[model samples]
Target: MNPALRLPAAAVRTAGAVSPRLGAAVAMPMFAHVAKPRPVSDDDAPTMSLARGRTIRIPGIDRRGVDVAVYEWGRGPRTVVLSHGWLGRASQFSALVRELVAEGCRVVAFDAPAHGGSGGRRTYLPDWLATYAELQQRYGGFDAMVGHSFGGLATLVATAGEVEAARAVTIAAPADVDELFRGFQRMLGHSDAVSAGLRERFAARYFPGDPDPFSWLSTVRRPLPAGAPLLVVHDEGDRVVPFGESGRIAAANPGAAVLPTTGLGHNRILAADVVLDAVVEFVTAEVARHPVSPTTEAAAPLTSRAEPVGVS
Candidate 1:
């Protein structure tokens, strides 16, 4: 059977089950596969194995440790951290990393808990945020941070006064978690009852007090910190995440710069020279305008290169 055809068939099978209990049981695992990410591809191996990088493990929410694959390049004073989206690894930012490094800035990027060289099979929004916090703790605050797709949203949430950064850039990011859930539900052709049940289970497990996880995680509801500048870049023809989502982010962060690209879609936007140049320009300008205080700038410099290390 065609892979695309299998999901709808499974949804029908689960929805047609005689007992709701049976339906929920059957449906939950399918949803988990959708939410959980797969490893990076063979084609991405060479880039993922980029030299001068190190991997480390950090304790995440609930004290469950997650391995984070990190790549560091350049030796400039300012440090920029990069975060990749769902199913995305650190090396996806290879182009941007080079650009930032050439601009005389240190660049750091990491694979999320369950993606790339990281450990575990399941990950959540909190895990992504926790990973950022752990990275900040180790490397100190960032001069600028860039996140792509879901990573972009995670960056926004993590940097909400929790982690400090001079400026932030979000690329092809979804503005609302609710909308993401809705899209997932639609993709699986889940019925209303099934969708409601899934929501209940998710909320109970991930967010006990919050009835609406979507609204709770919405970037618009929790705006970025005051005086922190943001840049939102989205492709006009992006099929994965609607361009309107970027608009929502820009509206929420009135000071944010919304840069719309023409041909580059979701992932390609990362490699586009125009996009990379824009990012470097934005960060450089922002850093100069709002320089990190001497205290914030006192953190020790990152090692230019290191062998990847795993935490016990």
Candidate 2:
């Protein structure tokens, strides 16, 4: 269960007229600066020691074009998909991707809808899940997946029922979607009614299946794929995503393991040695134990879900 905390009064004060849309413009710059993603080359592949891979265009439900970046390397039979957090590009995981590739794992990542090179206005959970489904249809089933922050939540939803992945990993992911809506509303100083209205509209338009963010915390829990292993890592010191989120995930899935960490807040966990190592170890171990069949090796999974926790 998610450990409860008193919501800070200051965190929810009203601003005169800042809208969620406007708040994004103001907050994105701040998030970009603090995210501190390393520079990645234009191609799907890594430069220097890193190899560039492939890019594919997926037609969106809205008739818009969406693109996903794919990177491949190593001689291993296993493939892994890495999903970045909110407002983050797949390249943010380049450091960990390189490490995984060196270990003989083929890695793939997406820019999401609006972030990176992909085209869109604001993104929602449904958009992500649709793109994820398209990729899975093309790539088949992946051995493991690692998602950071919002991507972690999306990954949980994406992998449920549709994907055939053997294991999953979430870093600083949220346990509840409502917490995110609340956090954003608080950040922008929106009134509760206004925030609820805006969030409901956004989800209905973009994320069709998502339950009311408030009720989904308990209702929309992402169940682990049958027989699939799960590992969750979160930092207690995370200022963005509370560590309690990870606790909820662990509580929901008895077979899932949780690693509570310290110091690394949200994005920094991407670069942290301990966190990446844990992910790599988990993926490699799962792959070794349940090796992908030779014929169906190159494909990625449909999607899966685990309980979500709020981290914003």
Identify the leading candidate in terms of TM-score.
Answer: 1
Q: 56-174 in candidate 2: lDDT tens per residue? A: 66544344565655555565678787887776777778678778987888787777655666655445455556666666776677788788988888777655545557788989898
Backbone clash count for every predicted candidate, in the order shown: 0, 34
- TM-score for every candidate vs. truth? 0.81, 0.72
What is residue 158's positional error in candidate 1, in angstroms? 1.1
lDDT score of residue 178 within candidate 1: 61
Q: Residue 247 CA error for candidate 1 (Å)?
A: 1.1
> Candidate 2, which segments miss by more than 4 Å at Cα?
1-49, 207-220, 287-312
State the C-alpha lDDT per candidate. 0.70, 0.62
Q: Write the per-residue lDDT of candidate 1 for residues 46-159, one digit (tens) a residue.
A: 555654667677654335676777778888988898998877878788788777888998888887766777777666666666666667787787888899998888777655
Compute the lDDT of residue 190 as modeled in candidate 1: 56
Per-candidate RMSD, Å: 7.0, 7.9
Tally clashing residue pairs in candidate 1.
Answer: 0
